[model samples]
Target chain A: MILEQTPDKSRKISWSYILLGISIVTIILFTLAPILWQVLTSVKTNEDISAIPNVYLPHKITLQHYLELFERRPFWLYIFNSALVSIVSTILCLLLGSPAAYALARMKLRGETIILVLIAVVTLFPYALLFLGVLEIIKNLGLGNNYLALIIPYTAINMPLTILVMRSFFRQLPQDLEDAAKIDGYKTISMLTAIILPMTLPALVTTGILTFIFAWNEYIFALTFITEETMKTVPVATAQLGGASLFDIPYGAIAAATILGTIPLVILVLIFQRRIVQGLTAGAVKG
Target chain B: MNNQRTGWILLFPALLLLFLIFLYPITRAFGLSLFTENLGTQLQPVFSGLANYQRMLGDGRFWQSMSNTAIFTIVSVALELVLGLSIALVLNQSFFGRGIVRTIAIIPWALPTSIMGLAWAWIFNDRFGVANDILQRLGLIETGINWLGEPGLAMVAIIIADVWKTTPFISIILLAGLQSISRDLYEAHKIDGAKPWQSFSQITLPLLMPQIMISLLFRFAQAFGIFDLVQVMTGGGPAGSTETVSIYIYSTVMRYLDFGYGAALVVATFMILITTVALVAWLFNRTKWA
Candidate 1:
């Protein structure tokens, strides 16, 4: 609206609209297709799934796969385990990461940069070897197949980014509130609890969701540590899904399970996408 | 000085956990890599220095996995970069339904990779899979191709799956970069009679280099250590052809229970990744934009 409608500007027929249309179509097809296909398959009968000519649409929709999924397998347990582990570990990550982040943000020290780099580098550490080491130590500590097995490592591994995001979030807060609280003889912890935390609810939620998603999605540790069937998380249990022989692909249950497993995260993403983006970019851009 | 002391005290818990969970385990892995310890036997102190390393060097499967890792990382990251940049460019535009589109874009990224890998495996299934059905519908192929059956096609399938899941991550990072660019530069370029492509190349790419490199480094390290997708889709099969270093090391440690050799493999993998990251970081630092 601000632009002067020069002859050239008026002559240009806004090809960007056309481009936008094409991009939207391509994005829908590429990005949404697989997920949509999974959803469709989730509702299809097994016969419909492997029909001679791919049954683009299900003739008869059924909740049988969903029923069978829960009946045949303890997927409820997997969901419960995933929820408990992710929730606890995400909390633990925030508790540990917040203090360090606050310290780094507030303190001006010679080795501050070095410490930040150290934290950042840990996130870059390859997990294959790291998981092997962690598993050994867990076994040595007599913690194999225990919930602590996954929780401790998940909390530890997610620390770097959590700290970085929290640090960036903390740095932006006004010093006046803390100074005012100090004048009233409010201690640091109480001040943080009453004022800073209550004020930074968005940041806390952002950090919490980011860590929650990471812990939920983690596979290798959960797979390796919890050899017991019931202890597996959704991701691992879904991967090693029973009833799918090499010959007969359990497309029905697999589809149902995939949809069921992913729907919660997708809902969270739909809600808090902006916050997640902030957390993701905060570390990369600042570093 | 007072603040520093207080800060350190505040930071103590995180530091302690890092030492316990991350640093200590890393150092212990390195130490364990030095000795030959078979997991079947008792925990004995028979130190066989460099033996595990020697075995790793001679192992064909190790080299195969190393190469497989290199191929997967390089190819997948390359495809993701191109697609991601395009997506970011489009998403950056002001248009109708952009909010919905942006949310849709992040969904693939939010979905767990391992589960998505499973989804992809099913989608690319030999007889009744959608990939084959779609291709055949388009007249691209005469018959259903067993996408995960052959080695090369399996690699392609996995890479495609990886790209689908991860491109959004690259796009989001680059979109953040794209949004931060000044409008004045584009307007100036427009006044100068520069083409859109010219503006993109001259104005945008240069400014977006830092984000580009960071995403590259981040994704490179991630793709290098890819496990779940490879594990789920192929199980590194059609004869261990798609097996990555992570899968190899994982199988050695978990399935084979070869602690010593797996440790050596771990150390080797660590060295490669660390060196590559350092090199990329050095390149990043050398670049004027960085």
Candidate 2:
């Protein structure tokens, strides 16, 4: 209504609407097209993808590329390794990170802020940098070519963020809840297990989901540490699509592998969509 | 009746695991940095002082990686922030299909980096890639450019891949921030005869600073430490143009069997990341308390 008095307001309104429209269209196309292209190419025969000025949609959909995917590599083994590592690491991180987070949140330590900051700092230390030291420790312990090597580091790197998230959620709980639980004669661990843990389910699920995804997608450490074919995780095996010796970089196969790799992650996101969004935003904004 | 002590006691298991598995290796990395070990013998870790740091300082390759990392982080993060904020604002509106669009938009971010690299690598293929195909069909180019093969274009390609996978991440965070802002504030601004731009600049942006900072922190850290995508896409190849610090460290320790030197590089990287993140945390805390 304020703009009604100003003639230029209509011009600006139209311009802004146009801008927003263009922006939306551009982002949708830029993001979705490449992904859709991957899917389309995956279903296309070799000749279709190789043809000049590729068709937007394949004339006939085929599962030949996907079939070739299984034929060319031990994808099942790689997926099994990925699942094993992701699940184990998620469990480990939650087990460690949750308690540490609770302690930091409730322990009344003199330098809780410093401890939290320390955890935050650790999140920035990527596995790439730490892989060297981790390798030596893993080798020294004779745990190479094992899932423990990947799971341990994944848990370690993810601990800080998990702790930060858990700590924040724990901080918001009323102290009286714990005091009342104690009044009811619940033991310390029992109180945590029965009362606090249930209250903090959302935080736990958030941390678990993020941890699982990170571990599931982890690559460099797995690549460097596990050379055995059976030990290779999804990311490592999928990355081999781009390796030098591969046959002309098999576009269809790579697309199929990419789709396969995205499936579990997409499923995780869909199932935990609400919790993930809630936890991610709340953790960041409040912290 | 002392619940706090018991809480700390309960924390011991987790703390011990962290100290043994996480803390030890980091400090060990620092210690390893001081040593030099030759591969041919049962070499003792002899102290080499700051020679490794000095070597990295003067190494052209390290500097190149550093520059590449800096460019990739700063530029892509800037774009992501801008795009993410706009998208978040749009999604914050009462529009149809918002949920569907938001969910679908997040697919790129949810997908793994290595997988994304594989997907984009196919898209960038000089021969059969969709990118070149689209460009040629649209008459944008006469011939397909070898996007990932060239030195200059390689960085751009990597940035494209990174942005595709991360803009949604930034948007999701910003959207969270956007949701926290009350409708009353915008209503108040409207009463004051504020334009949309004015409202955004004066109200939305200031309130969103914390979220923006966190987004920057997460994105910058991820970008700086990028390894899987570059490794999968480029492998620091075509004369090591796309090699990141992670790849460099990987090659040094695993490929060349120089554990001590590799450890030194890692320690250096850890120190830098910790220092930078600490500084940001401090700044945020100061602003918050002040």
Candidate 3:
């Protein structure tokens, strides 16, 4: 009976192992196929792109689509605008959010739970819903077509996530460290910059990357606020890539533009996968 | 008292910005909804109490968009939860090159939704699309399906794009929950002669409930307000069939220049979202108690 059971168990284990292997492959293919197809389409010539039988792979890869994309539109301007807005907003969000998070996490503040709950709710708000009012504000303040138009809102929009994630990280730290700093005659600002901030650098970087991504990818505000071609961000520019008529849709150039727009984010995700996951889950799970 | 002062000082800047951006807009939307300001009214602000809301009561387009938003949210969130859980389960296991697989899995979520939506549009194109080509090769269908041209299929296409893009987010959250569960529970369950399915149902599901609820609520809210994907892919087209509430409001405000009616739509959508979130939270808490 033992011998029979041993074989049966081994067979079952191998069967499940095989199943797991298949599932992993399927998951990878499902996630990566559309992206890989876009890459292929970008490199393919117009002839191959619109071929009757469909060209799975390019016959001869060409840089013409990429060239055409740059020549036809101000693609470089979009990239520059995206990077500037994302970086500035991320820096601003961190500057404002860190102290608030520290206060909520470490300081004996009144109504801390209410404040935190408010932050969480705000974090879940769909920003598109705020576009009409935000646009009005932008127009009235004459911030339209200016970098601050995107920067200010992006900074404010990202603050909740930044504060929530940082607060969670701060809560996990030992109270002894802050007490030690206090005994050393440190003020609140100095104590934060000198000790707590240095220790929670990873959390800062996590929140910073997440903020940068959000700012870079935001669409409605970018579209409504920046009408100038030179001020458009990657998402808005990419969405507006095709021709006026359906028949003249620039598939190849659009594909190239999509690839160009996504490369920066892809690199960021690959490098900071662990931190990104940590930041995203830190708020939701802990709360 | 000094420490409390310092704490409030530190908190003041962020709180002020949050209030200005979030609470102010919502309140202003409600205020703006009670006026008549659009192209037809010569873009001049006029006081008209409850007129826009009354119009919404008789508006078929608004109702259709609401139902569409509901379908998109329900179907996409449900799909993401199932797919995400499966991926999380697989990722939770130790395997060779697990890190690479995990990174690859989340690439979709990391990319901009608008750009990916465009890619999906091409993929679902009638003539040169990879989707049709593959189906034809596999003998699944003889003719190319006009994915974005048909009303029902347009919704399906957008949902597919949305599911692909967001499943990674849900999976990552679930994977975190899976990691927090103790291995001892599974081992103890096995010792009690529990099957793999039994252990998973009894141990994994119950333990992962909080994360599940959080992801569901987050995904539901995001999916309901979906704009970029639908805007880029179909532009809520093939005859307004795929238009979400966000898309409807966007057109009302931007295209039609109807600020008053748009504000009304915004306020109504916000109320619906808040109520649903509260209801879901209450239901989850009840389940937890039971």
Which prediction has the highest DockQ against the true structure?
3
Write candidate 2's Cα lDDT for A1-287 as tens digits. Answer: 67775878778878877876776677678778877888898998888888877677898899997887688778888889999999998888888788788878877765667766666666666767766667778889898998888888778767776787888898889999989988999976788889998888778888889888888888878887898987899888887765356556677787888888888988887677777776677556565
lDDT of 2 by residue, B235-275 (tens): 88657778878788888877777777777778877777768
Deviation in Å, model 3, residue B199 alpha carbon? 0.7
Off by over 4 Å in 3: none
RMSD for all candidates, in order, please: 2.7, 2.7, 1.1
What residue runs in model 1 are displaced by over 4 Å at the alpha carbon?
A: A1-14, B39-45
Q: State iRMS for model 2.
A: 2.0
Q: Scored by CA lDDT, what does every candidate get?
A: 0.87, 0.80, 0.93
Docking class of 1: medium
Evaluated with TM-score, which candidate comes out highest?
3
Individual DockQ of the candidates? 0.71, 0.60, 0.84
Ranking by DockQ: 3, 1, 2
Better of 1 and 3 by TM-score: 3
Distance (Å) between predicted and true CA of B112, model 2?
Answer: 0.4
Measured against the true chain A, the candidates' chain A TM-scores are 0.93, 0.90, 0.97
Worst 10 residues of 1 chain B by lDDT: B37-46
lDDT of 3 by residue, B203-264 (tens): 99999999999999999889988999999998889899999999999999999999999999
What are the fnat scores of the candidates, in the order listed? 0.73, 0.61, 0.79
Interface RMSD of each: 1.3, 2.0, 0.9
